[model samples]
Target: MINVNEVVETNEMIEKENLDVRTITLGISLLDCISSDLEQLNKNIYNKIYEAAKDLVATGEQISREFGIPIVNKRISVTPIALIGGAACRTKEDFASIAQTLDKVAKAVGVNFIGGYSALVSKGMTPADKLLIESIPLALSTTDVVCSSINVGSTKTGINMDAVRLMGTIVKETAEATKENDSLGCAKLVVFCNAPDDNPFMAGAFHGVTEADKIINVGVSGPGVVKTALEKVRGESFEILCETIKKTAFKVTRVGQLVAREASERLGVPFGIIDLSLAPTPAIGDSVADILHEIGVEHAGAPGTTAALALLNDQVKKGGVMASSYVGGLSGAFIPVSEDQGMINAVEAGALTLEKLEAMTCVCSVGLDMIAIPGDTRDTTIAGIIADEMAIGMINQKTTAVRLIPVIGKGVGETVEFGGLLGYAPIMPVNQFSCDAFVDRGGRIPAPVHSFKN
Candidate 1:
């Protein structure tokens, strides 16, 4: 029934190339879990995650074994806790308890991480939303599996200057509180301008208000596959390289669509979006940086690399568009510094720097991810990083975010470990120049040139 030549072509195309699926995320909406009583809400949170995610690890494992492709992380993203938990929570203690309960269920079910411990305050913040924001450090530091996010802006609502200001402080506190492990918990958090709700990725993933009440979304990863495809035609035309990536992405996303449909049927939740991101791991063969190398750059920081990435990103979208009708989230490529060994190595080798990373944000899926700065970096500097990245996304009308950790007591070139799947980062320097004027201009940058289109 199948074409033998096509099968062989795909095989020959992928031989010697290391490819693996990144995350098969289960997006569970917590709107139904809200209740007037704190006790009832807690009960609903536990039951929903456990019931929805109980078979997730097993399903992912079975699929990985069936396909001979390694599925790295099994994760879940929920509705922002503040929206669901605020009704019953009157104090930080009540909110902290809810965060603790969510973390417990994630570990119990063996998920790599649980996201959506978040708040969306682009327009304004509610009393309970304010409390949850204040408790982020305590919530994250006390929980192992809980990851948090805050959506401070969007194309429709514009950037919330006040919320952005609060987030800068919260991020700093989160880093300080968890400084023991190189401020690792800060690495698990994200601040976004236009974050999607059905995102099946971590650190920043959360079920959005527009998403289904319950659904299964898959974040398919195959950087190694793409890199492998590039290796086949070392001297091929750039157009040919792009074509190869597009074809490979088509196959990778097809696999993700299959997994999402099957997983949804098994769980009885509606099938959700498939995130086609090149999510790399700490392992040797799973690097996005490697793909850049295969594309002709010795490392990610080489010249012409940004243009190459833009091409790779565009081709991936072209392939993904044909594979699935429903595609969303920050899908394309990820460059998490600590998580990808090649990126970490590049930073340590002086081939990468914070400013260059900022430049890359213009062409990548996420921005300034997993970067570490000196412990003594001023709060204004961190806020400056957030503002710069947010401005890029705001201007381009894309979903870009930052997850930078200011490792307490660590200076440039020093390595800080967050243990397990979080990996580690060598501290990089931030500009010593003051952003006082830029940050103080804080009212709001307003929507950019394109944002004004009629």
Candidate 2:
């Protein structure tokens, strides 16, 4: 059934476009690692993860050479630490100790990052969830290669403003703790609403309790391929543009499908899902903002930008779903400012604002990401920003998240460089107003009536 032209076309997409598999994540359950003894808990945690993911990187590399597909990152995700640690950890330091174990094992296994240093407190914080939240600043600062996330809201649970208020302070503390490193620790932390269980992406990926004991998830990304394909129809109608993108996305996801199955087979792990997220990087032409431009935006934050993004996101799913039977994770286009140079330029040119970016998230995959705020920006203001985005995800019944960095000792008009895939960003200003009273209410924003569909 395989054809020569299909192979040729895929090769073109890979060689010319920046088409690549963004990540191949191994999701491992750690519920078995729970124990009352802190030392034994850390040991179990380390041994379990290292054993599960020991061959992941080597397997990925071997597959890449065989298929000529670039598998960008080999990563891992475990059960939320709070759930298991609740039974073991007596204090915040205990949680950080677990984070250290995660970091150490991640490096040993050659994984770029290990996720699930997380707490799910959508409805409200359990004592363990609160402990993990309190430990995040220290946990992230003290460790490398470990990412953290907290789910503060969900459609079924509404918004947890109590967690929101606390996360604002935690986000600030994380940045402050890593100020010597340009507040890089915040880059590894994400706060979300309706977080997905099967996400292969970092800072948000965690092995949901419902998943299998071991599974492999693949994230495919190709914004450059899409933008390049659009060149054939420079002045074409919207219908033609949509068709072109769908076809390009099809090629992108097909590569991911091939890689995921290959990796799974080689490693003896079951394939979970193919995340069709068009993850961009600092590399030129691999920008989602450029895709918006190719979709006919003068620049990213223009009048018709949101509409253009909505079309791109919808068509990508349409094309991707046809290519893979199982599609999960944040599959829409990502507009990470630091990672996408076009996004950074949009901000510099004033084509993008914090508010405009928020609107774009309504139509895109994940919400406000890699945005830098002024050091003087109030913690309450950060909480207010997260609350607004959470409200969107809650009302729309979709996943949205915030990974904001309050650049310490740096104000607006200044810049901070995180290097590597996490490039650099200008500190965008936030509203001066206060929402202290509203956020300080310390209660849940009840789930919508539509969420009662059960």
lDDT winner among the candidates? 2
Q: Candidate 1 overall Cα lDDT vs. reference?
A: 0.82
Top candidate, metric TM-score: 2
lDDT of model 2 at position 110: 98
Worst 10 residues of 1 by lDDT: 9-18
How big is the positional error of residue 260 in model 1, measured in Å on the Cα after superposition? 1.8
Worst 10 residues of 2 by lDDT: 290-299
The RMSD of every model to the true structure, in order and in angstroms, is: 2.1, 0.8
Segments of candidate 2 deviating more than 4 angstroms: none
lDDT of 1 by residue, 148-199 (tens): 9987777766777767777778888888999887787788789887888778
Candidate 1 runs further than 4 Å off: 1-16, 440-442
- TM-score, each model? 0.94, 0.99
Each model's lDDT comes to 0.82, 0.93
